[model samples]
Target chain A: MIIAFTSKGTDWDSKMDPRFGRTDYILFYNEDTQELSHLDNREVADQAHGVGPKTAQKLFERGAQVLITGNGPGGNAAEALKQMELKIFVGAGEMTVREAYEAYQRGQLAQGA
Target chain B: MKLAIASGKGGTGKTTLAVNLALYAAATRRVALLDLDVEEPNSGIFLKGKLKREKQLFRAVPEWKKEACILCGKCSELCRFNAVLKLGKHILVMPELCHSCYACSELCPENALPMTQKSLGFLRHYEQDGLDFVESKMEIGVEMATPLIEQTLAYAEAEIAGADLQIRDCPPGTSCSVINATRDADFALLVTEPTPFGLHDLSLAVETMRHLDKPIAVAVNRVGIGNDDVFRYCEAEGIPVWASFPHDRRVAELYSRGETLYDKVDSIRTGMDAIHTQISSLGGGK
Candidate 1:
């Protein structure tokens, strides 16, 4: 499964960005390959509307099956992600991407409402 | 000819000029006064003695059919407002976020989506003493008024076809709602006071009107209350000063009591007559 984490930087040591739609970077980690890749999220920051759903579409297109972020998705974004069968886990709380992924592996992260 | 009474700053007497001009012009010409300030429509206050006809207005949102279910996500991808989304085992449609463009229903391949009407506001019509009036009253806490204002103009076009003059009392500030109200106007009369703040906002409103490429004029209200900055700005910009009214306690008191002072006050009548002459010079003689 590919886990997507909203991050403040490209590396795993960067803090988790609380914003789901307008986060600086999204770190994608593949569990099988143990490889990490990041995508810049600056494009959706200045949108006047529909930033959340657009961000969700980015993740859905990247084949991310799971999302770990500081907060849950908004109503529209949550609906879109849920339709794509993407599981979302919260409770990162300023942790780095690696720490959040490890916590998810340990089953310590709560499912986002 | 269509005339729009607008103001950059709030409480600059846009309604005062609009109601009085409608009353004055209705004496000799066929006039339809449209109150486009949906958020706070007060033109009906002064014209309340007339009999009014009211009608509800609605915007077309999208409705989905559950049985024709194909989770294609085409509607979601097409919608720019994010009003449509597919959730777990279902499609979610939020009507409030819908812009009512009908693109979703038109693009649905399965033909499962249909246009649904959602209540936007009310249109109140009044005809008393030869003046035809209509006001757009938006529902409380509703943010968008452009649709309602545009609907009001359409209603005016259909209901008052032979009218010689159409006067719109636009809301203050040069936002999208104001653009929607004044875009169809033949001439825009910007109402302002003689203050620095009034001049500042007047310049902004002028820039907006310039972008719309409409002929601009100025109406200075409560002339004695502030300095001559508004007049100076209008002169510098070469926009005509159509009329000016003095700051009188009696006029303010009459306005407070939902009365128009055009008939009772001589100076006010003269000012309105000057405005009428300017409006008539637009080449449509009545």
Candidate 2:
């Protein structure tokens, strides 16, 4: 499963972004391969509207099975993510990417719809 | 000539000016009053007339067809608004994100996406003596106000084409909606107050009008309430201060009762005449 973390930078040491739709970066951690990938989402973050749905759609396209962030996606975006059966976990906005992954592993983060 | 009555700040009296001017101008020439603030169209609350016509308006949005789609994901890739998504062989369309730009529907390789009508708003026209009042009420929760304003202007152009002058009550502020309403006007009367916040926003609105290359003038409403900064700013910017209506207790009383002010107040009538004179100088008079 590829766990996606909304981040402020390109690496695991980067701070986790609290925002879902308008996050600066999307870090994907693959469980099987132990590989980490990052997608720059600066363009999507600056849009006037539909940022939530767009971000959700981008996650689904990138094969992100789970989402971890500070705050969850908004109404329209949550609906889109739900369509792809993507599980979302919230309350990691202030943590580093590595710390959020640890919390997700320990099942400390709250599950979001 | 079409004169748009707009303001940078709300409650600064764009509707007050529009209704009074249209009512005063109707004494001689045929006047058309269009309330283009479709989001909260309260101009109709003051101008009561016989309902002449009512029309429902629609905007075109793309609808995804399942069997016709080739699962190519082209439509989703082409959409800039993120309205379309390819989710497990089905291209789901979120109508709220659609700007109706037609790029997805027109460029679809399999012709799976087709444009369909979605409810935009409703327009109601009322005839009172020599004046024609048209108000557009946008559909609830519609964020974009530009398209509906354009449609209302088009309708007014066709329906009241014979009117000698048009007075449009615009949506407040310098947003895209305000630009849509005022872009085609021959002149824009920017109503403002005399306060600091009013002056700051008025400056922004004046800059917007200047950027659009539209001729603008100012009207300070609720006179004597705020400071003189708004007047000083207008003078420094070389924007003419056309009319000033005093802060009167009776004015508020009449407004609270949803009554027009032209016939009730002598000062309001004077303010209306001054605005009428300025517009007539621009060849609006028949």
Candidate 3:
């Protein structure tokens, strides 16, 4: 299945690839399954004060299965994302892009896939 | 004097303080209110002003000419924002990712890249009940608010140059747009509540003001609800406390209806006067 992972908060410019850190949206495609996954880095948008519901909706429409973020599944955002049938993962700290993908594969995410 | 009212966190009464201050100042002095919170500008709603679209602002994005273009990836290499993409003979420009630094055009070897203006948004002006205001509204779906804020600041500088006082209502957080809004202001008035979250974000706001080298004072809103952490921080850091507005349901009711705080709270006038006096004494009004 296609899976998308997003690193949120603190810009993470030096740790992650600069291209990945600056992107507000990321799309991952699985060639074998012909599936697409999308993620929105809400941390940057949150830093800018607030994120609109449209951003969350866009990720849902793009077929995101799970949203890997640093913030927990609570507050208004949790309820909003829950309505879209997207699983929320929190406490994913400082893991490399590949490591995060591996964690997803191992079913070690905070939210079950 | 240009006083930028800001807070690192939202829901801290930044807009309330700014609108009241502007209204109070406008009573005697000609005051202009410029809302630099382009992302979510609510000052107009509070002031109940009818906004007129003054001018639309645009920024230049690189447009590569296919006829004269080589497949050289120099443009992409030079763009720090990664706005330029080289795909064989095609060079695509993502306007959202562009910072308008024009580094790509400066480094283009074939001179195939020409900067073209893309509409970011518009600068709107309005007047209501003797209060003049200006706001920058970014085009819907636009990610960047920095350019629009910069244009708004420029407009404020040019138009409100000779005004007795100018109160700028800024967006939340200490990002580039917020920085641009308050960079040239004479003083920054940081409004915050007394909660833990308020104190946490107040520190961020302090750091930002220090970075900008702007003289700052704190305004504690909803004084009785939260603890004394904000006051303690102010006393420890030697940052002056300009004013304090208590947690009152009357104030909330007026705020919900877009009435200026000075009109709602009689005590606010005294605080505003003191703030004005303090600012003028600091030569901000000159």
How well does candidate 1 match the true structure in TM-score terms?
0.82
Cα error, candidate 3, residue B56 (Å): 1.0
The CA lDDT of each predicted structure is: 0.87, 0.90, 0.73
Clashing pairs in 3: none
- State TM-scores per candidate: 0.82, 0.96, 0.72
The runs of at least 3 residues in candidate 2 whose Cα sits more than 4 Å from the true structure, single-residue gaps closed, are none
- Which number leads on TM-score? 2
Candidate 1 vs 2: which has more lDDT: 2
- Best candidate, DockQ: 2
Q: What is the TM-score of chain B alone in each candidate?
A: 0.95, 0.97, 0.94
DockQ, candidate no. 2: 0.65
Model 1 CA lDDT for position A68: 95
The pairs that clash in candidate 2 are none
Q: What is the lDDT of residue B217 in candidate 2?
A: 97
Q: Which tens-of-lDDT digit does each residue in B150-210 have in candidate 1?
A: 9999999998887899999999999989999999899999999999999999999999999
Q: After superposition, how far is residue B248 of candidate 3 from its true place, in Å?
A: 0.5
lDDT of 2 by residue, A20-43 (tens): 989999999999999999998999
